[model samples]
Target: MEQKTVTYEVQQNVATISLNRPAVKNAINSDMHRELYSAFVQANEDSDVRVIVLTGSGDAFSSGADLKSVATEKLGDIDYGDYLKETYNKLLLYMDTIQKPTVAYINGIAVGAGLSLALACDFRIAEYDAKMGISFLKIGLVPDAGASYYLPRLVGVGKALEMSLGEPISAEEAYRIGLVHKIGQPEEFVQQLLTLPTTAYGLMKNVMASSYEHTLAEVLQMEEEAQTTAGKTKEHTMAVQRFLTK
Candidate 1:
């Protein structure tokens, strides 16, 4: 079988989605967009997969859009907008909504839509040298693939505005501004990423993301509901009972 543009592999309970065109820094074209969406959906539906990590293979995480595709001007196809909306925008939104935890392992440069994809993840852990940007303005384009929405919320209105106006941010700066959850030495990033506790991370992720769109009262109700549901879960019940007995 041909290795797909986006490759999916499961190790333990983690489903890893790797963007595979390293030769071009994983610049996303239409095929890569489609495959990425499919991979996230497939992982979400797999009960065996409790967490998902999205990464790219190479010295760079992803350089965002493949310039060749834009140069071809094929975005004028009849269903082009809809196709992009579903495959790119909706896919990231779905990944955010999945009850499973999603991690963006930013091993290198992440620009344009690539940065947006990382923002959509529940947590972002990056190598010290990893760089991120909202560089659409530099290319005379507006932000797409959900950057306009995800970026501001992550780094505050003023900073997000500054970045999206087209400057790049380093991994250290990103973490300082709360855009990344953690940073590791480039050589140790992959190993450090696997240290997250899957189940606890998943539960906390669902709660936090849901809070974004919910009213305070609604969030309280949801918190109660989620707590009740979690109380019945094996992990929750066992841990709580064990703690009480101790």
Candidate 2:
């Protein structure tokens, strides 16, 4: 297959999706957008892929939508709003719904839809020096790619509004505000981030996703339900019996 804008590789059970356009800061052009959507769908279908990590090829995660592409394209030929609503929106929606966990390794700048992509992930692990922004306001545009939805929920409505309306924020500040789950020094970030797959982070991901929409009472019920369902699995039973005997 001719993979251009995005690349996918599997290690253990984790599927890593890299945005390959480093020359342009991994900006999301139409090709990259379509490629990412396809890749997510592929990962969802593959039973071998128990977890997914979304990252970029170079230092920057993504610069958001390709403004250069947007500037030259004619709105008359394509109904962009409809196109995005149907396709791009579905990408975030699917990411949220995927049974397996997903993580965003924000190694560098993540802006606009790029930030939304990070937000949509079950967890965001960032390099301490990285920058995150909902920079749509800078270009006189509204947030898309689930920014309008996820931002408010992640950082609360007031904080989300301020961040979207304000300039970009540093990754450290983002961590303090709950936007990012962990911040690691740039040199050690990749190695540090690998621990997430080995930890209880995947279960935490599922818990957080469920907490986002469910009430506290409902959430407790869900936890119990998950416990019961997981308890029946051979993997869970083996681990439980091993611990008991030990």
Candidate 3:
């Protein structure tokens, strides 16, 4: 794809959609939002891509919305809610429905909406030196880009509230609280995800996300339906065959 703010590349079944604004630490702007949505579409449509990775080109994943652009605009004229409705709402919703696993490679600072973007991913692998937090409070803004929904789910309501009122935490702290899957190379997790059954992963993602909001009986029904779908896949059939033969 011919993109400006985001770069798209696929390697070893992993489609890497990198935020390309390294000069400003990959801070997202309107252009970046458009490009990112397109890149994700491209990745989702590609048959070669088993996993999708969101990362940054420089030392940071993203610094969040481009405050420089905001500074230049008339504050009274800006409708923040409209901006989100037009921009990331669709992108984040589409990401939730992605059949492939997604990983956020937090190489450095991921604050504000940038942190929210990372939270949208199924797995987050933060570099050891990365700093992350719900940093919207510093700028007198509430968390957007699905941060408000995802943050509390990962770290519990109490910790999420504390982080909202405080500074960015270290990658180690993030890992300790279940914010990130690990603190190391993103490739390690991506490679492992690629080796898993893609169909099962997608099914599990749907069921697990539903598990949080549904009753036990509802979730059990969801698992029953998902398992029926999974059991029909060639991968599952092959595994069953191999097991019986052994």
Candidate 4:
């Protein structure tokens, strides 16, 4: 089956969903939004897929929305809120709801909604020289696609605001600010991330995502529940047996 705009592949328990529009720096259009959501859903539903990685085909991860597709006449008539509601909002929500761990392997420049896409992932690992930022203000738009929500959570409110208003930062700087988990050569980066235990990682992602909106008591309860579910997994059982033998 031909996958348009995005490519989905599974190898060694990792499902990689790549944005395929290299000519425009993998800019997301309506079609890409649909394809990406489908890719995530596929990975989430596949029991063999342990992790999902999102990246772009070319030098840039993504440059955000395709401006060429936007018509001047339609700009005035466009319902911006409705546009997001139908497209990116749905994709972001679906991504957030996936129980599996998600990683944004930011290979290069990521700006505007592209940054938001990376922020939504449970972890971000970038090429050492990659540039990343929320650049919606440069085009007279506010950050959409969950940037406003995830940015502050990742980098703190003050730093998130500053970065949103400023130019893109290098991957090294992004790591220093905790925007990215790591920066390294592509091969090493992916290898390191894939070493994580998938079932445990997913549960931890759930705990962290919930912690932001939940009270301490509620978060502890959530952790206990998630741990109970995770403890019953085959992986967990095998790991314990291995530890006992060792």
Which candidate number has the best TM-score? 3
Q: Could you tell me which residue pairs clash in candidate 1?
A: none
Per-residue lDDT for 67-106 in model 1, tens only?
Answer: 7866356655546467567668778767766876678889
Tell me the spans in candidate 4 whose CA falls farther than 4 Å from its real position: 192-197
Give the alpha-carbon lDDT of every model. Answer: 0.80, 0.80, 0.91, 0.87
Candidate closer to the true structure by TM-score (higher is better), 1 or 4: 4
Worst 10 residues of 4 by lDDT: 184-193
- Itemize residue pairs with steric clashes in candidate 3: none
Kindly report which residue stretches of model 2 are placed more than 4 angstroms away from their true locations once superposed: 71-80, 185-217
Superior by TM-score: candidate 2 or candidate 4: 4
lDDT of 3 by residue, 1-246 (tens): 798999999888889999999999999998999999999999998999999999998899999899887755588788899989988898999899898999999999998889999999999999999999788878788888998899999999999999998488999999999999999997777878988889998999999998888999999999999999999999999888988999
Instruction: Write down the TM-score for model 3.
Output: 0.97
After TM-score superposition, the amount by which residue 224's alpha carbon in candidate 3 deviates from its true location, in angstroms, is: 1.0
lDDT tens digits by residue: candidate 4, 1-246: 368899999998889999999999999998898899889989999998877899999798999989777787678797779989998999998888887778899999999988889999988989987999888888788989999999988889999889878599999899999999888654555666676667777788779877978899999999999899889998898888989999
lDDT of 1 at 214: 86
What's the CA error at residue 110 for candidate 2, in Å?
A: 0.6
Candidate 2 C-alpha lDDT tens digits along 46-117? 877777789998999999888788645575575668868875687877787676667799989999888889
- Per-prediction TM-score, please? 0.86, 0.85, 0.97, 0.93
Displacement of residue 137 (Cα, Å) in model 3 is: 1.3
Q: What ranking emerges by TM-score with the best candidate at the front? A: 3, 4, 1, 2
